[model samples]
Target chain A: MFKPFAFTLAAAVLLTGCSAQSGAETQGGGLADSLPSLTGDYVWTVNAQKSTVKFEADYNGAFSADFSRFAAAIKLNPDAPETGEIHAVVDLSSVRADDKDVTNNLPTPAWFDIKMHPVATFKSDQISKTDAGRFIADGTLTLKGISKPAALTFDLKTDGNAATADGNFTVNRMDYQVGTGSDFKDESWVKFPVKVSVRIEASR
Target chain B: MSASVKSTYTKTAIWLHWMIAALIIGQLIGGKVMHAMDPAPLKFELYQLHKSFGFIILALSVARLLWRLGHKPPALPDGMKPFEKIGAKLSHIAFYILMIGIPISGWVMVSSSPYIIETKIFKLIPVFDLPGVPRTEGFNALTKDVHEYMAIAIAALLVLHIGAALKHHFVEKDDVLNRMAPRIKVRR
Candidate 1:
């Protein structure tokens, strides 16, 4: 009898200890905390009306949804892309799918868990030019409070003061806990990879 | 009321009967399989296909009803009791109502859902939602429940209908089953 009670006490203590650590970690940090300070010649603000942030969750079939509201700030010089920085904030609650059922369930715990983690963020640590008009921004993508290293490659075309970037990237859905459970392990229904595509129109 | 009472059903009646019967059974099984599935892309596709089948059944049911009205069926065997005859008639009426109700209810449920996925029949023909249907969660849930109950009712009706047909064939030893038999030869 006493052994069971002592075991229960130990488990409770361990659970509380874990929660306390996580709580502190989540509250203490902000999305921009780790971003590199940018001092590039051109600071571009993304036009929300003109830009689109969409994701495709594919298994055997493809179901796509879009983040209706997102904002990205870029500081870069076309000549020195290595010194550039990109930061984007996505409102997880604003995700809308063509199917109403999909839209309603997206903010739930199985997917974005928008109640607990309402915002997803990306802040680049490195930006490198692979070719004349193409660049890759490697960054930490924080979603549902889980951070993972991700990369976005885009073709940048600049004409005078206006610029456009069309990019696509793939991220493992399981890595960010988007659909991690016994049911989703096989990936028979909703596949593991989620493709995120972005088109940004911005000006200095 | 005709001078010569027809002993067997017309070819058109037989054709519609078997076609609708096969489709309804398929819909019942497909509905069960799709409902138990986890929410995924394939599940969504199955639902769209299911919707396509539902509409097809609805259309066929309409055609079947019209065909039924224009063509009087062969008279029941002389020995069928009053209640049995009534039950047979009632069950058929119920089937027609259900075949029509099930698909329409499903359509209403789909229309009411807040998430609007376009209904593409077999991923080919685009079928639009019923106009003026309220797209609310409560309405959608209610319609879904109604659709499910209608499906259950149809399943029960199927058991009764098949049992009656089997009884007419094996126990009653009549030509009732022979009327709808696809390729059976009969002496006029």
Candidate 2:
């Protein structure tokens, strides 16, 4: 087997400063207010060259993004797997979402501007399973000064040797004030059903 | 009779020829089996071995080809048919092309893959030197596809050559077999 070098992401952390301060002024300590007791590092690699976003999401691109920056830990009963808890932090400001100029354009005012607010974090409240055996983790996603409830569907498996988890979810940028810097079609909107996947090994 | 053919082959030359032949066939078999296997660490390891042997084939085949061309092979007995000579030359040309192509293509494909861990064969000599290529998510797939198709081409040519040789030996009572099979004349 190949060695799995892993780490978790905190949206590369820069955005975390401004957003954490904003959340303290409003929602209080951002996701720190609701933390998951899990501890383990998870790596998410995002190849903007590999990622594609459309109004309609495709599942096969249900892939991973490298987050050599952050880690995660989970607490769930084997008997009541549905009652699981997990948390993930991404260097929201580290947008591997584009290369060079495109990247700068994306994390700017009209988009996910990492300049003013750089960190985006998530904390799960409920973890349940579908009839088809996939996981649905519902949580609050905190970015900038906004906290919104979002759910991610994960195909997760755990064994004594290692654990793997993957999920893809799409949400509109407008809901998070991530909009184009324009007027006319002001009702105009672009949603990024950002595809995300995670694979990690736990040491204890 | 050619002066080179009158004398028997040197042991090293003979060994190099048969070894190249045997390993090329072995590499071909390994390539076929590797294709059917699922993607796993073990499967990847098998492919690594196949390419290692493939490099050996290229080297030995080159030696054998040079020895054959410079040292003329045993001539056919008097009155050999013209088509038999033509067939022998065509088959050899096909074999040489494939022997060189298969390994070169495999090396290129391996070099292009980002997932490839070790480029060394037998812990010596760097293999498939083209780096900076991503095997899993980029241009490597196209070369792999071409390598596979060309393997089929080589296999087809091999079958035709073997079948024709067998026909000449068992059915036609011709000297074609005697030229390559050293012991047949003694048996007759």
Candidate 3:
């Protein structure tokens, strides 16, 4: 009885390992290898009124800041996601925290350094469809005079003349020199991983 | 040692009374010390803990009030003066009012404040603001003053309550203190 049970457990473990390996293989495979590349030029204007960018930081407790002003330019073909291009600019000065003290401190030199770098930009170099209605944009994010490569995975829904894209990604604040000195140098107060989320509604 | 003396309080009442007393004292100290500290992560954590305890005090006060309504407390010792009885009743009434008022005022201040930080009980349970409280600077300041003044009033009353209990135990040599004290068996 013990021998048969051990054999069954081994088989189960092997099947789980094989399934996980295949999942990784599918994701690692290039988008072009799985889907046909669409080849059409389309322009979409980001509706600022319906769009929002928010960042959540964990400092003993979870708190979020919202940016009101931003602009984006998108050129994509739904049939050809690989041919898509996205460029966006976020007004760092427009960041607002729910707490008055945090809101006042956010634009100081220790944090966003909004006086020196008032704008953060993201330019996507490649876009790939990972699953139905799901896509990932591999891009460069420039903030506080530092540029770093970041990947944003988003879900897209298009209806008639309107399209909406929503996604979230985590960024290490230390990488961009945000809150780099004194009390903020360590993870004692504010954790490094800040979750950034975006919801963009655009019109063709 | 007679059973008819009725010298002790019900176990549930005694437990609630002591629990609320200990928590309130700790909360008052935490609130004062945390307020004096500068704005830092530790200060923030202490304030959250203070707020959590404030709500716990409120819940316990409500439960204690309900229990008091259902059960009569042990009577004062025989031959107690009329003025002393009135003083005791009035002071006990004030204690209950302050116990309930301080936390409610704190809740109002938090709910009305323009600063929109979330209130979590013990950093675990998320609590929303009380409805209809205006989120304005003027309103916030008013509620804050109320909360602070009421807290001071509670502190004053706590001193008096403890002093009265001590007097009853040491001077009057009555069961007033023993009614709320933990039960202890005395060997013959």
Candidate 4:
């Protein structure tokens, strides 16, 4: 189980390195254009204040929440929305809930199992938008070596120079079988459904 | 000065000796376990502890040597065989050499290393400068080799020392572990 996780981590690092090299090349030789842009590098800054991510269950009122450190990169082609690509990593381990008890339990092997599976990642296969300014990001969320079909939706707004989008989704932690919850240490009532709110910045 | 050399150590001498022994044991294990870790904030943290403790070994070694000249070591048991005495003395010499050499080399290795500081001393003082011999990229690799090979040699010697002590305890029936033991007997 951890073998694949380790391999993927190494692969992720390598791919990230290659992508950064390519991003650097694309960033050169031009003044970045602002407002409703998609060609240059655009980083989605997670607005923790506006973002609310929570996981709920029968036994627990709200045992899980993700903080503002959530971040990702999106390569959007505003003219050709089909070509837009998104890569985001929610350091689920980085999630700091206001509740101390819940926060302590989140990083354990029985929970996020941060030591073995450190980062939870989402890479979009296809992203589409609705006429209502709401956006849909479809991709496989790889958690603990288990890949599942996951879709996220939220509101997106673009002014003449800047663009912003938000999304919320719930995932049954058991789908990936993150860890078998316990009554004392692990809470089983709520699935690890993460709500994502993102704001991306790009040059025109 | 006598042909029949001494066998016992003074109170302060024994304390320094065992303290160094304890520190070396702790550091070797620390270095081994820490080196096994991948690069992370905590792994680097462990390396800092290991490095600081290593420097302690270097400092203690110097102090121990300085403290030794002022003290009179007790004579060996009058009944010991001649060749055994020569061999015992030779091993002690090796131990002293290794005590200082290995850590100096480690410091040199760290100095030559571009990333790590020369002195992680108390985490207070940063690297001032590396003393003795020119510092270069090549020196780092060479010092690393020296530290590693010296460790192998020291470990081999330690195994031999223990084997000899066990041999005396069971076969020779001499108090081989006596000097390093809880109590030493003095003869008039």
Give per-model TM-scores: 0.61, 0.47, 0.56, 0.45
Write candidate 4's Cα lDDT for B122-168 as tens digits. Answer: 67655444666455557777887898788778778878888998887
| Native-to-model Cα distance after best TM-score fit, residue A78 in candidate 1, in Å | 8.2
lDDT tens readout by residue for model 3, A1-204 = 221111100000000001111332121122112222223335564555556677899765789988765555566666576777766666677778776557866787778888898767776778887887777878888888899988777777776666677887789999999876555788877889998888776655
Predicted candidate 3 versus true structure: per-residue lDDT over B1-188, tens digit per residue = 56754556788888989999999889888888998886577898897898899999999999999999988888887768999888889988988998999899889888886555578898788888899998776898898888888778888888988998899889988778877887667632
Native-to-model Cα distance after best TM-score fit, residue B128 in candidate 2, in Å: 4.7
Preferred candidate (lDDT higher): 2 or 3? 3
Could you tell which candidate, 1 or 3, scores higher by TM-score? 1
**Candidate 1 accuracy as lDDT:** 0.72
Give the number of the best model, judged by TM-score: 1
In model 4, chain B matches the true chain B with a TM-score of 0.82
- Minimum summed lDDT over a 10-residue window in model 1 chain A is located at A8-17
As for candidate 3, its interface RMSD to one decimal place is 6.2
Candidate 3 residue-wise lDDT at A56: 90
For candidate 4 chain B, the 10 contiguous residues with the lowest summed lDDT are B1-10
**Candidate 4, TM-score vs. the true structure?**
0.45
**Native interface contact recovery, model 1:** 0.21
* Reference-based lDDT, residue B142, model 4: 88
Taking every candidate in turn, the Cα RMSD to the unseen true structure, in Å, is 14.1, 15.2, 14.5, 14.2
True contacts kept of each: 0.21, 0.00, 0.07, 0.00
